[model samples]
Target: MLCQLEDDWTLFTLVFAVALLVPRSPLRFCGLVAALYVLWPAFRFRQAPPWNARQVIRPAGDTGSPMVSVIAHRGGGHDAPENTVAAIREASKNGASGVELDVGFTADGVAVLMHDDTVDRTTDGSGELSQMSFFQLAKLDAAAKHRLRDAFAGEKVPTLEEAVEECLKLGLTIYFDVKGHADQAAAVLKELYMKHPALYDTSVVCSFEPRVIYRMRQADPDVVTALTHRPWSLSRFGDGIPRFSSLWRHRWATLMDVLLDWAHHHLLWRLCGTSAILVQKDSISPDYVQYWARKRVALVAWTVNTAVEKQYYQDVLHVNYMTDSLLGDCDAHY
Candidate 1:
């Protein structure tokens, strides 16, 4: 409910304006106080960014503490099936320093690694994940449609515990990408951290939803958190809803996107207590990077696949990046 209010910039602006401009003195004073409370988080800290760039932790097996700049997107989906244990293993075997794992819940409340709301795209099943139990999910072949299906024919959907154990055993840094269920996810992560305290340094909980990060910090202040952003996300590349909607709805969504983009750049990071920002690869450049750097926030880019792009992110941008494959044309030599 709080996150919804924060994200509704249009409503807030209207309420704020009316409250301050009302002829009643009591309402104007209340409005002024409420405005300060909302703005407090932005000014509370002297340093804008929480994580120090110099102290960026390395994957467990690496020599000397040089940063692990290359991360496997969806556990190196190009090498194997995405979000499967096989994919995670492929990433480590091929020299990726880290892997990004998606977390979603089943009907039985089991947290598992899954990128989409449905199993149709990656598995042999054809239904919403929330409607399926862990038993049903466990029977489906997660790699059934992959190009390398023959090699990973029997891959099963891995639970969050299974994925985390595999990543830890392989000494790979983990990025837990939560898509929804903010409070439930935060509770699960808090329990995991309690069991494996090392995750405090080896893993980060990241989400495009600011509410997820906010809830995470509220649940466990010590957990590392990051905010993921892709400019014009809803207006352009998103789940197909906006594209199939009415023209007027699309225009309203585009306007909202612009407002949200400004909030992401200006207030959301601080408001959510994010340590880093995971930006879409296309929006990254020297100037954009400098803007975040001036405020001391470490920037990481996503879906950088080509060798040239990898090299540029390394040599030119000097930032960490996530890629689909750790082999073929996208290999990054550690």
Candidate 2:
């Protein structure tokens, strides 16, 4: 912002000097340019940008340390049905910066807002999502498993379109978790983005699969892609290494794959800075938190649930974002 202001001021000064040197140059034009250069930011500051970049540049909201940005895990899973419209709406009410929801594809090749391949756990249905049509999937009560009508009254399954609309309606940001086979997620996201061009600025596309994250970028070069991991997924961590072969280009032949593997490994090693150190709940380590914070990598963790856990992340370890299944009332603790 300062650089931008400096450039504008420089241009205005140049224009004013040129006007004085040229005898017939319009004084009104020069004055107007100078006035605009000074007043433009004032008008912008008054109205404020959506995220209010000016406020952050000036250091608002607990500037003492790394900001505590709260991301709703599966849309505040405890407050409402996990990964459903009702839950996302409640997450907005709780003042979450971003709502993270998972995506999978249906048998009919339509994109679905689900976390698993099978609907059995989250909905009143059985079998793989690959075998179901959108019309067939739509009939099942998404919240049936939660028995949420006792609290929420009436909740139903929502399409991705519906989910996006609710976020836009509430002026809430989203951290969409693209799951399932990389190709399926990529294809669905590519098709969906066409329907919501306005969402690009406010949404982040992330996945445990780097290929999926990369594919999201290939679809929309401007989309923000974030890396994610699940410690429990055996498919994710295989024999002490990442399962995905992030080694070679599909468009390349055998010769390039070997060279690329070395490069990626070197890069990964460099990123695993200061060696690995484990910190249990009874102990604290602020330095470990500061490490990722310095890297500007939006550090996040999963299913954190206690005050001790939250403090370990925010006050001690300093994690940037967290997904929780049951923890609530953060404003009270923080």
Candidate 3:
């Protein structure tokens, strides 16, 4: 709740600051225009029903397959320190078919498990992951910042190689959420997959950046890949303005999001050789679900935490889904 309030405040301040740049009458007009520009799309989408009438097309040789795989978001985040070995093990124990973990590079180009650019939020240390060497990161306790720190204390950040070894040993599927440093990360993934060819059939490489997914396809066409999507409303600018990021300061993030959306809606998956589409839960509708299913593109929903939402996606939508919690409806057939 506090975070939400802070986001709202930040957004308001940004708008007011911009408005102050204009003359009085034009300022009021500009404010009104901005309000409409932002709110109109959200209002329309909320009132609109899920698109369900479009005819789905499947390219030759493509076939629809029913998939009900249970994926752990951040490797069962609620049950363990996310992106750690403990979380991977717990997800497998909880019956998850696979685990999704984020990958980033340290200062020395060592690939490690991390969702944020900085370790401040998820570790006892305070510093950018990209600025710290792996040796430096190795000393920080990764689990100290988790809610169940006592249970997972002393858990150090695991390297991409270590994570792969653990997942392979446990016979669990690995979903690599490429955060950045795509080229470097792709090299690490390709090397590991080459070492264990069996992973080719069990692992998936997914990311919000199309270039990253495209690069992975270039590295190994046989490797399964997915493109993640979030609707404009749920995007970085959806709830409130983003103040701290360089992307926001330059105002290019929103433009990139628009282009990405166009690509997703236009079936860019075919060109990128992606076998799946990972979408935000609320942004999905019956239409696109059926459409993707017909295209032989597996659909995966993310961060679904509530039982009702889980049942709706699994039972009604009949698509694979990822969840933060390892308990409740999410645990039913994991």
Candidate 4:
């Protein structure tokens, strides 16, 4: 217990720092107690040995190439209808080493590929995604809202099973991005990994929520896992919760972001036994890259689109990244 506490001393330090911010002595005491109670699980955590991330995320058929490995964001959303099987195939066709796809459960509890809580954004259908059955989702055209809709018309939202099969068939690595439904998503992944043990090598489950990654490890420790983070993400307009309107609300968000960032950097990785961090592209820097390198954590940047940006990540950072389109800017001579 003492050894564990020594390793996680930073967590207690952060908690105490947050507690000290409460103006009232009685309330601060109560809040600190409550916070410690809530975070007790972290105190008991013993990190598992880190996975060999380079091997796990290596592109299929890779012949010791030195170029940065690229993953298709939402299965190359910019070129194909996002999250559809068509998009997955498009990613493979465009030479992506892997595809990052979102997974959400339907009203009937069937796992399917989707990004938003509602189908309004990606499909012609207008309704809550969680309220719709898979049968209903199947009928909606996923490509309806895309600029290239005509080219990819009649594309149906694919099930998680179908997405897995297609990715495995194409020898593409899979990054299952789960937004919520921790237990259910973990159960589904556990089943998939059981059936396809190779997933242990070629895939990872990632989420912004630590509980989701915790659940994935609980369900099956063999499955590789990563945590997604965007610094100041909690305060970002339209990205986190609704904008922090008032000054106090904004300040509170800033504080929360600091704590969250600290946890992402220190506390949660150890607790979750994460092998990598999928960070926003803008946050990647030499200092940041070197820091994680010291910890032996693989860094993967997301949504890198421009030719210049891709070249920089490849030649400078020399790290893996995800892009919205694997086609455009890909043919440029670096």
Q: Name the top lDDT candidate.
A: 4
Per-candidate TM equals 0.85, 0.63, 0.74, 0.86
For 1-334, candidate 1 gives per-residue lDDT tens digits of 3433444554457567867676677866787768766876454322222343234333322455545468899999889999999999999999887899999999999999999999999999999999999999999999998888999999999999999999989978788999989999999999999999877767888999988988888888777788899877776664334553578878977898898988787677767767788998888999998987665567889988898888898788877899998774744221
Model 1 pairs whose backbones collide: none
Ranking by lDDT: 4, 1, 3, 2
For model 4, the stretches where C-alpha displacement exceeds 4 angstroms are: 1-9, 12-52, 58-67, 238-242, 329-334
Better of 2 and 4 by TM-score: 4
lDDT of 3 by residue, 1-334 (tens): 4533443455456567767786789767677768855763343211001111111111111254434677888888788888999999999898887899899999999999999889998899998999999999999998987778999999999998888899989978778999767788778888988999877767888998878887887777667788887766333643455633675544665676676676675435655657778888777889978877665567888867888987888688876788886676433121
Model 1 TM-score is 0.85
Please list the residue runs of candidate 1 whose C-alpha ends up more than 4 Å from where it truly belongs after superposition: 1-39, 42-68, 238-244, 330-334
lDDT by residue (tens digit), candidate 4, 77-119: 8888999899999999989989999999999999999999999
Off by over 4 Å in 3: 1-67, 233-256, 329-334
**Which order, best to worst by TM-score?**
4, 1, 3, 2
Over the stretch 1-334, how does candidate 2's per-residue lDDT look in tens digits? 4533544455457567766776664677667676866764443211113242211211235555336556677787667877788888888887776677777777787765788778897777788888988988988777777745467644655677788889878866676777747777766676666778656556666665556655555555545455554332332242334344654433243344454333222232122211111122222246645653443333455555566676666676555454543345432110
Per-residue lDDT value at 177 in model 1: 94
Local error of candidate 2 at 35, Å? 56
